[model samples]
Target: MMVDGVVARLRELDGELAPGDGVAVFNGMYLAVTEEVRDRLAGGRFDDPAAVAELDVLFAGRYLAAVAADQAGRRPAACWRPLFTARRQPGVHPVQFALAGISAHVEHDLPLAVVDTCRSRRCPPQQLSADYHRINDVLADLEARVREQLMPGPDPLEAADPLTHLVGCWSLDRARDAAWASAQALWALHRLPPAYAALATALDESVGAVCRRLLTPLVRRRSGGGQDQGGQDQLECSGLPSA
Candidate 1:
């Protein structure tokens, strides 16, 4: 239901924003992932397509809710705070925006979605682990594609490159590992009054902080306000000051 609706919302966003817009870049990547999942569900890729659909809807709801909150001038969850605020900033790269959104969604929102799905389906967390892992695999594949398509390059491994440092620091693999742990913890604490909420809040705040750091602007230097790198022309920021 809601998962079906999310695809429409993402398409609306894609049409409204420019290609280079930070939010638009990330939304496009996310839209790809969501559509892939939608196809997988329709093709019966999972043991319980209905349950997987529920989880996907709940997971996407968190992101949609944050966008709504930001539009309304209200505070969104901590994990979403960075992407929402930095998405339109001039110096922030589209790759950074995409990764930051992924960080927030996977690290903070996903585990909670898993728990919620389990509760809704009257099942244990373990029962949903297969679907969870399958979804993660999808994300992992998409991340590689995103980097190939969106990353500005001078070879990310080049020494003394700021982008290299940023790339090294942000990893979806690590985030997914933490999310799985959080899901287990949340399931374990499900019946404990207040504790579950507190843990979830802590997870949200911690992931948000990571996203904030990831969105931190790196110095962009190029001539004539743009440059060709890795066979693609990119608009880059400028300026330098001596120490």
Candidate 2:
């Protein structure tokens, strides 16, 4: 139903975004991955297409809400603030912005989305596990492409690079596993509204801490206007600064 049309709205938003903004870098990659997921779901690759589609929509709404909040001069979620605040810092690599956005979305919004979808669909978290993991599989596949395309140079990232450590700190597989656990935890705590709310607050704050580190400015800018082939102005590794 709305699944086929969802990409249109994301495309429109991507078009409206300013070039070189950190959010734009992440949103652009997200748009591509969303397109891929939409295509696979439409092609009937998922075990429960309807369930996955609904989950996808619920998950996307969080990111859309953050963007709206920032545009309206309200503070977005703590997890998203790093990307929004550091968008034009000139020293942060685009990949850091992209990963930070993913970290915020997956670590914070994703578990809540899973719980919300379960409540809306009148099912337990276990019922959605099959298709939930399927969607994550899609995300994991696209993440490699996102990193390859957004790395600040034509050369592959060196093994000893500091950026390697930054990227490694947020592993996609581990993030997915943790998100599922959180979803199950939230679902269990839902009947205790106060407990649910407290855990949710903690989740938001903790994920924000991780994302803030991921978005920490990782490079030094050139004194002149020299630019890399990646079109970024980053010149060399600057020690990680306090975010």
Q: Which number leads on TM-score? A: 2
Off by over 4 Å in 2: 154-160, 221-243
TM-score of 2: 0.87
Summarize candidate 2's per-residue lDDT along 1-243 as a digit string, tens digits: 265556776787889988888898888878887888888987888887888888888888889889999999998988788788888876687888889889889988999999998988899999988888888888898789877777646544442266666677778888999999999999999999999999999999888888878876665444444555433343455544343
lDDT of 2 at 140: 93
In candidate 1, which residue pairs get closer than 3 Å at backbone N, Cα or C atoms, i.e. clash?
none
Q: Which stretch of 10 consecutive residues in model 1 shows the poorest summed lDDT?
A: 234-243
Q: Estimate each model's TM-score.
A: 0.86, 0.87
Model 1, residue 25: distance off in Å is: 1.7
Task: Give the alpha-carbon lDDT of every model.
Answer: 0.81, 0.81
List, residue by residue over 119-220, the lDDT tens digit for candidate 1: 998898899888889999899998898777767765433322565567568888998999999999999999995999999989999998888877777554
Positional deviation of residue 203's Cα in model 2 after best superposition, in angstroms = 0.6
lDDT accuracy of residue 98 in candidate 1: 87
